[model samples]
Target: MDSRSVSSRLRELVKFLGTVQGDLSNVTGPPSLLAPSSVVEVGHAWAQRPAVFAAPALESDPEKRSLLVLRWFLTSLRSQLYVNGAPGVSIKKPLNAFLGELFFASWTDEEHKATTQLVAEQVSHHPPITAMHIADREHGIRADGYARVEMTFNGAVNIRQVGHAMVHIDRYDEDHLVPLPDVKIRGFLGGCMYPEITGTYQIMSSAGFVTEIYFSGEGMISGKRNSFQARIYRREDTKRREPLYEATGIWSKGWTVKDVRTGDVLEVYDVEAPENAPMPIDIAPLDEQDEWESRRAWAGVLAGMASGDMRIVLAEKTKIEQAQRQLRAQEAAEGRKWEPLLFRSQEGEDHAVFHELTEGTGWRLFNERTKGVWKVDESKVVGAQSPYRGELTPLG
Candidate 1:
């Protein structure tokens, strides 16, 4: 593009950004100098000012990794700034999301507080945020090998569009996050790798054998694992959501989805339990620094990133199954053995272990063996393999 065209576009883009800023979701009421000041001040305190990523740096031979580093910096900068610029005094985003159902150490809500009266209930009710930064890269496509790419998902169809990942490194100011043993973010997003899978359905009715409502879409998400299969289905005259549940291996537990008009849970085909329960990761809790209210933030980013990927894999497992079926058809024509997702390969008679993982099996591993047979849901065993994929991890 010519310089004149470029300048014209920049002018237009800037105006568009300003217009959208006036109306965005979860946004602070209005723009005030003071509102942004708090966020900017804290943001500036960080060791380095975030550099907005540019394609030049990302695609450049000498600065590819640097571009990624800058990518993290810029995205983290926005979240930090936004949190610090949250609506009330002390520019921090409210602690409510992080607190869940537990009464905060300095909780302001009386009814919201968790008294010593109900410990077990509180524990079951609250699950940590896992990841907090709003500018999450996990939901987007990975900048694979510095290819310098940007991907989008409609999330109206395939939930496998969600991706699971571990933000091996997370640094947004002094509150540095360097997992001692390394941590992975685990969660899900309504993103996708393919948009063709995104499909929406209307609640016309479900009164007979055709009592099923399915809306499929694709999304690119990261939490637990990278990518997922997004599915919103109505089964037995009920609507239940399993975003990225088909092809991906991750499963969302105890999540409640309610209709906006009249809070009703969708009862799609019941998603069964899995074989293994997720292994617990050691988590450090808030202490003295927490009560100080000095930017009361919880680092659940890692957990969400880890689990999101797990969910993505589970969703993607559906695709894997379809591919396997195709492979089987060919094999049958040629007379060969079909490779099941969670089958075993043995080098010798005494050494036999599980091999591939079906989509359901992947869900078992992602959820860490929570659903499967009697105690486990049979659906989870539909297909599965071992849960070990040589993923690249971060260094200490």
Candidate 2:
């Protein structure tokens, strides 16, 4: 893509992210990384009305105010990826290439910042909402000597995906770990909640490669409008380790990682990708899911590639390992195992019911209206009859 087009697209994203709000509840990995209550709470607020806080709001919600601060930081650091360019290190898709790893790397880290008066005018808007307030703390240099930066964490130190990375901090040694809720974290949390994102950049990354990927989606969450754009970029990394799988769905599944060029397909369990399913399932892995209750780490390896002085290395692909299986134990019943079988007899106009048997319940009926919850003794449900193998797929 040319500098003009890339800049136009990103500017739109910035505008859009500015509008929506989202909550990123730390679903896995560590509690210390983000305050449990706040992660979800704040993330939801940001995702829902992200734009409200982008521009100054005369009358703003308190929660929205805090989110505005966080957004500022993300926007700024994204600008830096491009600014940090040397001669051949051309910036391209400043945000995508620079922060790809932190968020979810799908391409080589390259510069994509455009150098133009209008681009500069657009970027010269605001500052990041974060900063290293303390001198020495959390891996800072020297016992008391620290090197703190005010760079864009282009990535959110908060927020967690439903089935991806982000786990409890307590798992890795509770004593040494400090929860994000502690006042220490809140006060120093990115520091300077005042101005967000270091004032916009007049410049961006210098050189980089962009992949041919595009994504567009719209939905309603909790009765609010939602949308997203997935930008993918990749450069020939003969050195970088090829992914275990080709991300045929990357364009649709947000930013993702894969070893499309490698000989191995990373598989920790025996499973099959169910037709039209978001993820594959395996009954075997479910048994060991509890061990990773609080945390589970994936194997992240560096694929060797050369980019200038820094050896071109693919970012680590670490995700919160989750066990997805039908729980034999019923959520309602104490110790009984629920079966996955469904039985029905013709009644009325072919009325049918779906049962999600768990450990305790015996043939519990599902309520379609109640989101398939088997809480009640039985609930009247509709649309449970199979269409006799005749299903209408998405419209072309």
Candidate 3:
């Protein structure tokens, strides 16, 4: 699509967003704006790509592996900055996920013969919180967490992503806690919508290493767009006068890592190269997936959208949504609550693990709007059929 056409589509999307904002005026929670695609599709957009997560599995050192995991966490931010779709399509709203909706996929590392599995579930619907668990069992690496987006409009849209993720290296008995960043949508008046992430997030490890990453946008005088710099230090160093490592780069493109004391360059991650590009996730066939699986649940709607039939898309989407609402109402009338199949809520004593890691960090690990902190049920996966069926496929 040409620039003019893109701008026109963006204008239309903005107008629709404005309508959604108006409708949500009396609502107390996050705004739900239905896009041309389902929330399941957009969830994949923010997921950690196969390449980034797979790289950490190749390393064995706790500290060095932790650093690579941090790199993957930073690189994952790039996914949130740009929308995925045909060329020139700037902003696309993501459909709200119904309660209990699930999205499952896997990423394979061909060279190492390793596979990383991802299981994401929409655990709550009112405030729309998503819980995701990723594991590379072969490498004894696992990450589990949940997040919810809270948006506000004041001329432009300001979105705050509230939640945290915990990465565990079972072999080393080490854990890394990472936080999400806030996003700002600009160019409302200019008729083009673009996202800028601005915030400072941290990656803290149980192995006594902490990395503080700062993100900033282009300034009128000196700074560049999507620029970020991170400093890694040991926990026991009270003075924090010296950093063990320093990383600098534009997040969307790449970053360079260097040792502070030795002044030796470690590694450079360039997303532009074919070899360094992210690998695609493999998913189960729609027919073979469970009824609640994202692809299976939204098959009709997605198929309609792909075929350019707006009537079919809207009708199918509305049917699914209406059915969900009816189910919720019936459950409410019967005084029963829906339970997630693959995850369980963490209550009082269960929060001990979260508190232990977040202590002194001044970070709220769980969003108050959510039902409760969530954790994956490992037993559910032990004998379960893998949701993904194929080899590593390159993502477009």
Candidate 4:
């Protein structure tokens, strides 16, 4: 589509999205440019490559294990931004997730003989935050994190992620803190909107290794899009002149890692390689899924969007929002507060592992920003059910 037509379409979309509940004011335009999936599904996209996520568990050496973790993070970044960065397919606003909404998926890693499970929930609605937990019990790898987009319009749409994730490997007793990056969705007014992530982010581990990654697309670094450079060095080194390993390339395609001392190739990760393909995620059939489940709850809205029926999309979306409002009102009238079913707010040293890992680093929990430092409350997950007192809240 040309810029003129795209501009008109974007204006209409922005007007409609502005009326939606929660923080959706800064979404870029055009229905055709929008993702058919909801935000909860988008949250699960980061961990789509399950084999890469489980790779670190297979490495026994501390240095190799650290590099594997960095590889997993880079691979996941490609999965998360591939749609927005791809040609023809560009930046599209996803449906905002409603509070209490749940998403569940799992994939089996044949090589590891392990099942990796993912659970994500819309823990907050006003500021719009999604908390996710992924665990491979057999491999003893667990990652817990929350995210929300903070958007701004300055010619182009600038999006900043407002949370952090921590991954813990049980075998090594290591904790790795992963930080998010800043992204810009450009070319929107001219019709073909695309995303570019530009900034520096890091992965700090308790094992005393820090992987500093810099994303400098186009003019800043190379003339290519999605270009990045990463260095893995000891935490004590402030200057970081001598790194143990170095990685450089475009994340959308692939990157190469080299041993700094030996000047030998270490690993090459290609995004389009058959081995890097995302494993199929499995979920229960819609008929058998709980009313609170994301797929079941958003069935009507998703179907509407897929069929290009805006009427159905608006009606179904409004119905869910209204029910949530009424539920909140009832709780307020009874002088009670709504609590998350699968997660709990963490305060102080409740998450001692995370605190210890992030001690010297500039990173912080940002509890106030996310409403609370949300962590999985395993006790509540047993025989999981809706937290609502009476019947499940009717959605869709």
Candidate 5:
């Protein structure tokens, strides 16, 4: 937490960035810059607590549940934007996920008495895509998605997230399509690297409802940081002139939901409170996880980082990267492509799936890409069970 240590960490990260730049210049594929821990560890940073997905499970009404889902999604942005623990905090770079690396965790919602499980896998390395699946069988809710980032550096770092997520509630037989927002990393050269999320995203439900969200940062003359506004509309209404619900607030702080027609405030989200605190995810014991599992694979590197020994960190990190490179080379020699373990990709048919899910609703999939839509393997899910209990372990 000391400024000197923070500065030192930033310097180290910048040095790693230089290596990445050089590697890219040489036309190598994505450079591996694994921090002292696993990329799976970085994933935990996104949802420091687990309750984000639990909100929908707690809601019984389809329409109200959709609103809760949107709120949960917005709340997650707080942690996602401040990955280095908090604003202005300089932390080590996140570990780059290796192909096929798996991360599994689960959390129990004490209030709802439901268990939520999350399964994430690094499905692709060249484009660095991660596939994730979350399920709460008790509440008949599930979500599946994939994430990939395209980054560009021009004074400030701009990151465009390319992915879509689908949340399904069996009770309502509704599917919610969620898109990610763009991110900007500010003050890189000034030595205060922090993330600023910007741009518009949408959440469309199969129940003829659509929520349009706009993200913005503090302006010189007006606007506060992490400001966002969302309007929900019923798709069947052709004019789209009136919204059913509206929400406005600073994402990091909280927000208020209002019934637009009645002009009555419905709910307020106070994210900082202990009752609304993030649910803790339980990870399987390191020894029980497979060698390809995130925790076990990066155990040495994590230990090195905890001990503040960069020598050990680098050695372990290099070993993992080298092994990955060798595996790729061997696969190429054998004329084989690495296949994902838990997700299946469908090319040119993502829009079809979107249509199927949002059939009755007027909402259409926007910004649909051809990188192929990735879906969880239901067969695998049917057989797999949560590996951990309610007790959460330190990520390191």
Candidate 6:
């Protein structure tokens, strides 16, 4: 374009941004910030720390493997909450994902000759359930899970995760069920909102070991942010329950795990350490990606978000939503039910394993809540391309 036109566009962009900020300034209640990402991409954060996610598969001892799993889970919280690239102390709300929205990514560890592939899909839209599957073929480790997020306003944005992830180690024939924690977004009125992991959750394993983590938010008087205490124990020892290992620290920063009997530190995970940084995820180029791919599907919205143009952002978002409504209407009119191409309802032996892992806990697979017990249909996931290639829908 000519210089005059370019200058005019820049001026308009600045003016629009100022106007947005001005509108926020006049708000009388808690204001929400627009995050520069979509919720579908948030599922990718679980596998960002690929090294941690894959470590459990390499360990032989079931106890040590359980500890490694706990470490991996705690380390992923920062990435999950800050996926928008915002400062640690600032978290904004992301765009809700449309049903069937898919994301594909992989992390390659050349030194270890390991590749961890991740696939995330928005399986349910009414309650917003995101299903994720991460597989490390080289290590025989596979994780499949879904997150059903329920957001409510109680002075702050309180979120309760109503789903669990199951990690299976093919070598040991073991399964680990990891429950999710609740979250509270504080400081909205102050204009800087941040997420705090709250409440308690547990990880139950088929190998007879379990780990429970308790999260404590910063108190008004004295306490640290992201602080937590976790205990690993044997499942059978309920009466004289003595923890095998304990972990304590701020999850957003770092934590140390120690042997309960000897008090010897086993491992330390530092969130900010250079060696502990999350591996970058590799995604296909937008042109090479399928129409249903997360980045390709939301290209326009992403561009608007990147350029800080709320007008374009809202318009693109509304267009997609309207298209989705139309597609649902068509399905109802034709008496055809829409099904996920990559994931299917959990059946057969999968049900038994899930039941065993969550036998005594409150983390049962809520098939009804998530629409269905979703699992990756490995047969359908052939390659980097999306499984679906028919007519374009809302996601496309």
Q: For this target, which candidate reaches the highest TM-score against the unseen true structure?
A: 4
On TM-score, who's better, 1 or 4? Answer: 4
Highest lDDT scorer? 6
Q: How does each model score on lDDT?
A: 0.22, 0.19, 0.69, 0.75, 0.68, 0.76
| Native-referenced Cα lDDT, model 3 | 0.69
The parts of candidate 5 lying over 4 Å away from their true place are: 1-37, 41-61, 238-240, 356-371, 382-396
Q: Which sections of candidate 4 miss by over 4 Å? A: 1-8, 11-33, 83-87, 220-222, 348-350, 385-390, 394-396
Q: Best to worst by lDDT, what's the order?
A: 6, 4, 3, 5, 1, 2
Model 2 weakest lDDT span, ten residues long: 116-125
Candidate 2: what lDDT? Answer: 0.19
**Model 4 per-residue lDDT tens digits across residues 1-396:** 676667777776556545555334333334455566667766556566666777788787777777988887887776576554464555677766777888888887676576778888878776778888988888889898887677766556677788778888988888888887878876555466667888888888888888989987755354777789998888888574479999999887899999998999988878888877777889999988878888888888879888988778778777887887787788789997767768877774576766776776666766677776788877666667644324756441
- Supply the global lDDT for candidate 6: 0.76
Q: Using Cα atoms with residue i matched to residue i, what is each candidate's TM-score against the true structure?
A: 0.17, 0.16, 0.87, 0.89, 0.84, 0.88
Model 5 scores a TM of 0.84
Task: List candidate 1 segments past 4 Å from native.
Answer: 1-63, 81-89, 93-95, 98-127, 131-140, 143-396
Task: Count backbone overlaps in model 6.
Answer: 0
Report the number of backbone clashes for model 2: 75
lDDT of 5 at 355: 70
After superposition on all C-alphas, the RMSD of every candidate to the true structure, in Å, is 24.1, 27.4, 5.5, 3.1, 5.4, 6.6
Cα lDDT of model 5 by residue, 189-213, tens digit: 5566667778877787777677878
Please give the lDDT score for candidate 5. Answer: 0.68
Q: List candidate 2 stretches off by more than 4 Å.
A: 23-159, 164-389
Cα-based lDDT at residue 90, candidate 1: 24
- Candidate 6 per-residue lDDT, tens place, 1-396, comes to 465644554454334434443212111121124565667777566787667778898898999999988987887788787645434445556767777888889988676667789888888776677888899887899899887887655456567777778899999999998877888877544445578888888888889998989999788898898899999999999566689999999888889889999989987877888988778779998998877777887888788878878678778777887888888888789998767768877643457888877776656566667676778888778743543656665643
Candidate 1 residue lDDT tens string, 253-298: 2222333334454322112223211112112254432221112222
lDDT of 5 at 279: 74
